[model samples]
Target: MIDYKPVSTPMSPKPKLSLTSGTLFDDPSKYRMVLGSLQYLSFTRPDIAYAVNKMSQFMHRPTDMHWQDAKQILRYLARTLSHGIYLRPNAPLALHAYSDADWTGDSDDMVSTNAYLIYLGSAPVSWSSKKQRGVACSSTEAEYRAVANTTAELRWLTSLLTELGVRLPTSPVVYCDNVGATYLCANLVFHSRMKHIALDYHFIREQVQSGELRVEHVSTKD
Candidate 1:
């Protein structure tokens, strides 16, 4: 839609899509081709990452509704033709990340979406937006899982930087929006409540106790 009217957002806020809601698209091949291009575009255009990820879930059986959503992303791209990630020269060597979860975001599977964005100084270096492996029992559990995911990414990035002879001035910090999840990262008293995710609990707790990472809560408004 080169001349189509541009949209302010990539995906609609209401009427979340489902797996079996709409009639199957007649042009499945074309849908996959456009989606493939969008997937490549997402590497440099994080603004469309979440929308692209959501559309990808229906790649195997894209419906007309999914195609329309995909086109919405294209319309958004039209409005943001000049937007892209810019890594400033001599940016700080420090790393910080923001992690969040949309609890039970998937109406079909009841699975939460875990997302994290890692910044090396002012530029985003790594990011992910994917559904959790299993349904979360609570919003705190979803948020905690997101933190654990972010922590894993930080660990790898730290090791990579160390090998490259780059030492950060301070330990990496993880900003999460959930108070319960942030508290769970530093306190063992919440262990009993999170026994189901014992591995993630211990992994993040280890980093927090040893001062390798800090998990702090921030207001969602921020």
Candidate 2:
């Protein structure tokens, strides 16, 4: 793929990858090797997190379509080798996280993809994109699950900051695009729709009530 023509993006706006859609790859070991390398690259290239995570789901039995997706990432990297994450030393210490989810985006399993970006002032410090553990009943449910996951990450970051003697002036703010999810977090009422979710994910509400985190609604376009 070294001399392949460069593409504009790492993934298509409408991807067709699925467990049953493509022919099985003949060499599983080679596919895993390349996938592993890309996974490491994702530590700094948050732009490719969704593509990398999508392809990784097929590591056990990669197909030609999977290899095609991997090559697209390489082509994207080749076209923009000079671009990478930059952190600013002068950025504020206040932690803010933006979280979103693609409801039932997976073609095969119908699982939602949860994503979050953690920023210190204007600079991003951590981010993640992963498929959810189970199927969500509604778009709101998917978004709520993403909030739960982001809240867990915020808890860890808060602990780490405390250990480093860094003081946060106020509760860490979490921004989500889904109004229903934000309302669910802010309200204590356990509706029938929310009973299916595990008790552990409810920690986000506890943190909100205890003043450890603040969940807010943001526009999806932002």
CA lDDT of every candidate: 0.93, 0.88
Q: Give one digit per residue, the lDDT tens place, for model 2 in 1-222.
A: 779898889887655788875798888788899889999999998888988998899898788878778788899988888878677888778999999999998978899999999987787778999999999999989999999999999889889999999998888999999998998997877445699888888888889889989999999888
Q: How does each model score on TM-score?
A: 0.97, 0.92
Q: In candidate 1, what are the lDDT values of residues 47-66, reduced to their tens digit? A: 78888889999999999999
The C-alpha stretches of model 1 lying farther than 4 A from their native spots are none
Pairs with backbone N, CA or C atoms under 3 Å apart (clashes), candidate 2: none
Residue pairs clashing, model 1? none
Off by over 4 Å in 2: 190-192
State each candidate's clash count: 0, 0
lDDT score of residue 55 within candidate 1: 92
